[model samples]
Target chain A: MTTATIIQSLASGLLMGLLYGLVAVGLALIFGLMDVTNFAHGEFLMLAMYMTFFLFAFFAIDPLLAAPLVGAAMFVFGAVAYLLVVRFAMRAKANIGMVQIFTTFGLAILMRGLAQYFFTPDYRSINVSWLGGKTISLGGVFLPVPQLVGALVSLAAFGALYFFIKKTDFGRALEATREDAGAVALVGIDKNKVFALGWGLGGALVGLAGAVMAMFFYIYPDVGASFALIAYVTVALGGFGSVFGAFAGGIIVGLVEASTALILPPSLKSVGIYAVYLLVVFIRPRGLFGSI
Target chain B: MDDAHSKRRLRDLIVAAVLTCIAALVPLFVKDVYVQNIMVLTLMYAALSQAWNILGGYCGQISLGHALYFGLGAYTTVLLFTKFGVLPWFGMLGGGLISAVIAMALGYPTFRLRGHYFVIATIVIAEIGFLLFHNWDWAGAALGIDIPVRGDSWAKFQFTRSKLPYYYFALVFCCVAWLVTWWLENSKWGYWWRAVKDNPEAAESLGVVVFNSKMGAAAVSAFLTAIGGAFYAMFVSYIDPESVMTFQFSLLMALPAVLGGIGTLWGPVLGAVILIPLTELTRSFIGGSGRGVDLILYGTVIVVISLARPEGLIGLFAKRRKEVAR
Candidate 1:
């Protein structure tokens, strides 16, 4: 392959990694704090993408502008879901972990069905004047403007999240709860409210990533399933509950995927990804950066 | 104690044998191809689900990638038959061996993780299989490999005339799967599996070779599942990645165990008895129309079952009731 093609693949990998990092961060946060698997985690992204697609198609709102609304909407959705489903479900005996996993699985199917019935099984995308004929030449490499913008947005989001989690009281409270729920409750913080906010924040981040990813990827009911699988892999490889590990894992996966596509057939690229998932599973069961 | 238990078991066996005899005579009374096809499919599913139960239910591994083993067996036997003019009965051994090996490869690494990790690993491995099989040119890519019909021969695993042979083949496969499950439940290894499943660390501390026990369960489970796959290929006389290796196919195996009582011996049998008939009826009604109506219904039901009654339908009767002393 030519130098430009190699660079393009590298860029694509990095861009995809950024997107993966966004979703992984959300998944990690929720999993870290709540210890719930959230099999429907990817479906929230699906909902966001669908919303972004329709908003751009019908209301002429740009995806960047639509991201906030989707994030906010998902925040509310997450809180409500936590209250209605996660709370009561967690209240049951601890032996019912499979119940939680399968419940989210069922919710995922229900949401997919709703999307399929209402949206129909057609490929959807946003049509924007700016997205048309947009290309940027950077550092002797060609990068799509949408991808660059998405990476920047993802970086900014991660930066803000880091601050919120580390610098602020609510973030600290959330972390406290993650470390010790009973202790956090003992310290005058409303444990329920903290969990609700954490869930909301995690949902919002994933939703925003979905909206941004929609600009590049096509929309479908099963679109999230594939990506969700990848994000989970990234999370585990990075260290199950570590935020920084997510970044490391995403980039590693993205690079591995790009390099494999270079060496192997495109159809067999998923095998490489799964190979890494299996390798990490065997060698470092807790993940490269995970404590557990 | 042994005498009483054996007597009761003999009575249950007689009842089960009578039921099997009635089921075996079903083809004699039914001349319709449609009913015969349904019976064949039901038996195949029943067999597949039982195989699935060995790992997912009894061992508590919850493998969502059981289709990998199933497809491996299907492809192996089909390839052997098509390439070498080998008889399927002999070819099925190769298929079973290959499938068992693949299961071992997949299960060895992932079974180390607790709970959900194992589930995710199985899913990812299945997806890997789907991608490879879907894209490989040698396996006919997405179009799939086909075994040529060299006239009707029982040895060739091709019946030119009717579906009766296939029906009997599937019935025998189901019987074999049930026998395997029965053997597993009564064995010391079965007790070890239960101990490890309930608490791996405890089992390990108690000197149980946890990994070996799990691998053993996985191998047996996969071996039986591969046999089902072998039967499925011959019955349909076709094999393809899209048709057979889908994640939904794996989930279909799990559904039986999930709905019948996950770890119970008769779970898959009851699950297949209840759901397979309904799934067949729905497939007939909606599959031809291309609306995905059956999948939607099936997925919805699975979700509901998992959320509300995870112990499944059998849970209602099987759970021990606390005595009220009022």
Candidate 2:
């Protein structure tokens, strides 16, 4: 392959990887804080995409502009979900793991069912004149405007989250709770509040991802299912609870997916990603950057 | 106390025998093709769910990618029959053996990962299978494969006029699955599985050979599921990656077990009996326009059951029975 083609693929993969990382980071954070794997996480992304779609369809709001609102709305939805469903499962006396797991699984189905009932399963896309039909050339590589915006926005969100986690008291408390809920409680931190906040933050991040993606991708109820699997793989490959690991793993997965197209059929791109996932799971279950 | 226990056991056996006879004779009395079809599907799901229970319930390894085995069984049996003119009965056994081997290979490395990691790995494995089959032209790729229709024949495992033969076939499979589950529940391996599930470290300390036990359970589970898949292929007379290897298929297999009672002997059967009819009826009545109401109902039932009764409907019955005994 020529250098230009390689560079172009790498560049596009990197951009896509950032968004993948953003989606996975939410899942990783939630898992880290609450020890609950939200199987409905992709549905959250689906909901956000629909939210963005509605905003664009009826109100003429650009997806970029709708991102924050959608994120905030999803944050509330996530918090409420945790309070109603997850909390109950957490409090169950027996079979805690099975109960919690199926709760989220059920929620995923419910969300998908609701979406199908309302949206009728048709693929919908936002028609943004500026984001659509535009590309920028950087040296030897061409970058699509929507993808560039998605990558930039995701990077900024990641940066903001890193700052919040490292520099803020709330973030420290969240980390503390993840380590030892009782210890955090001894220090006057409400463990439930921290857990709820973690869920909300996770939801908001994926919400932002969905909003940005809606600009360039199709919006459908089941669209989140495949991406959700990819995000889960990214989380596991990144070492479960580590945000930085998720980011790195996402990029690696993206690069692997893109580069494999050079030799493999496009339909089999996921095979390459899954093969890497299996290898990582067997060889280094802790992931590349995970301290845990 | 021994006499009471023996009496209860005899009564349970008699009840089971009677129920089996009734099920076997069902196709004769209820001649509606559609109802028979539903019964066949119910039996198929019961067998699949029981197969899942062997690993997910007994071994405490919630594999969300069971469709891998199911798909493998379907594809292998269909391919053997279509390509080599092998009879489906033999082809079904071949499919089960293939699934068992694959399960062992996968379970060896994956048993080390706990909980969600295992679940995720299973999903990835199934997706890989799905993608590979979807793209491979030899497997018919995205277009899928259709088995040529033939007149009713026991050798081909095909029925043209009546669904009776298929019903009996499904009933027999379902019975065998239940019997296997019953045998496992009474075996030493059953105790080993329960121990590992309750506390792996403790079980290991006591020399439970956790890896081998889990692998065995997975192999058995996959074998049974594959047989179900093979039957499904013949029953449907077509096979595709989307139908057999998707995550949705895995979910459907697990749903009956989860809804009825994971790890329990009759849970899968009860779950299948209840859920299949509910979905089928909903689909016939309002499915065309409503599209997803049944799914919504399923989601609601699952959520409520998980939170309120994780042991499922059987658990509730057991509780009431205990109360009555007291």
If scored against the real structure, what TM-score would every candidate get?
Answer: 0.92, 0.97
Which segments of model 1 are wrong by more than 4 Å? A2-4, A91-95, A182-195, B1-15, B26-32, B283-296, B319-326
Best by DockQ: 2
lDDT of 2 by residue, B1-326 (tens): 37885676567667778999999877778888899899999999999999999999888999999999999999999999888889998889999999999999998899998767789899999988888899889989998899997677998999878788888888889889988887787689999999999999999999999999998999899999999999999999999998889888898899888878888887888889998888788778766676577678878888998899877778888898899999
lDDT tens digits by residue: candidate 2, A235-263: 99998888888889889988988888766
| Chain A accuracy as TM-score for every candidate | 0.95, 0.97
True contacts kept of each: 0.36, 0.62
Enumerate clash totals for all models, in the order shown: 0, 0
Residues B12-66, model 1: lDDT tens digits? 5675678689889989999999878887877888788888888877778888888
Which residue segments of model 2 deviate by more than 4 Å?
B1-12
CAPRI-style grade of the A/B interface in model 1: acceptable
Give the 10-residue window scoring lowest on summed lDDT in candidate 2 chain B: B5-14
List the TM-score for candidate 2's chain B: 0.96
